[model samples]
Target: MPKHLNNQSSSVSLTVAAMGVVYGDIGTSPLYALRECFHESHGLPVTPDNVLGILSMIVWSLVLVVTVKYLLFVMKADNEGEGGMLALLALSQQSRPVDLRKGLNVVVTLGLIGVAFLYSDGIITPAISVLSAVEGLTLTTDVFTPYILPLTVALVALLFMIQRRGSGTIGSIFGPIMLLWFVTMALLGLHSLIQTPEVLRAANPLYAIQFLIRHAGVGILVLGSVFLVLTGA
Candidate 1:
């Protein structure tokens, strides 16, 4: 193969591998996000209108925050080809004049806090993801309920055990698995969508606005749940 062809293949492989590692948290969140919207803690009824409203909120949030804000705008603000809060802070500090050093201390402090939050997410995300996956056993059969915690613990242990092999090896394995996972999710979503074509209307922002208007008191709670969709974004 030509050198350019080899380079192109390498780039594609890396992109798929990156998707495997990066998409896992956000990919699995849908398992609980919609259901949590109607959880008893939220005090929201599971009416059709409420469901549509919640769906609308989720769709619009992904579009606005993930697609527009992060992909389009934030991705362009990378510092030395890196992104995230620390990179943004570095870029900001670099752009500012050295004479304006008074507030730089505050900026550095906030950047450290952001890094702390990132570390917390790294710890919390996998625990929640594993728990959510194992919890699905309960839906299949109550007989599995008692084993859920133990099973989740075992799976998490195995996950960490494999981490010693490093990210490239993990990503190579996870990449194809994630591709299959996404395909399955797409098919399942399509089946449900066929049954309730009306849900497609929830893609419109008007439904979300109306939902908030109709249930102003509980709208805050619903928004909290909807925010879950952006957990790993």
Candidate 2:
């Protein structure tokens, strides 16, 4: 009976729990995604259009993927809301025999693949998060240089040390903080939009075509980076 789903099915509870498990994956990324977008991928003298184009794409993708695709479409695709391939396998079996149309085998295989990738992603995400956060310590002192390993160790140690307590208390009281995060992100994007709305001409699929035609390699990289953002929770 987690707060999100009161009196829901055990299957629904399982699905919501899976969603909660991945919150860390999304939280870990906000630290670097945008910086990587404009600085590393788009490159500087980042024109307003470039920023707007990217921002528009990011926003709409969030709407499409998070709002429409996952929360709505994929969730509807859930097997009793437990989700993933394993759940789908169960539904397929209930509907027909395993050998009937190979549905059981196909769904089960895909389900296992999803779980495998997610397991790897779960481990890699936390490591990358701690690594990136600890790197911030380097900015304050050269003395911390020789101790990067130790600093990382200490930071990671502290993060794990708090795990048993859960962050529910902090999350409950810090609703405003979360709001500020979204507000600030929106404001920065609005600022960019105000500067060069025309860059939004890139919103046209033609721009994508031209971008691909002109700078195929960089375009592919930017697209790949954008794909990562779309994959965010």
Q: Over the full model, what C-alpha lDDT does candidate 1 score relative to the true structure?
A: 0.86
User: By TM-score, how accurate is candidate 2?
Assistant: 0.62
Candidate models: Cα lDDT each: 0.86, 0.60
lDDT of 1 by residue, 1-233 (tens): 99999999999899878877888678888877888788897788788888889999999999999999998999899998999998888787786533444555767778889889889878877787788888988886899988999998999999999878898988887888888898999999999999989999999899999999998998988898888878889
Best by TM-score: 1
Q: Give TM-scores for every candidate, taking all chains together and pairing residue i with residue i.
A: 0.88, 0.62
Q: Model 2, 1-233: lDDT tens per residue?
A: 68546656655544444444444456446565555665553563465545555555555656677888788777887776598656766776687556746444666667678878777765656566566666677778776677777776786677566555665533433334445555676898699779967756655655545544555567566655555554346
Model 2 accuracy (lDDT, Cα) = 0.60
Clashing pairs in 1: none
Q: Model 1 clash tally? A: 0
lDDT of 2 at 221: 64
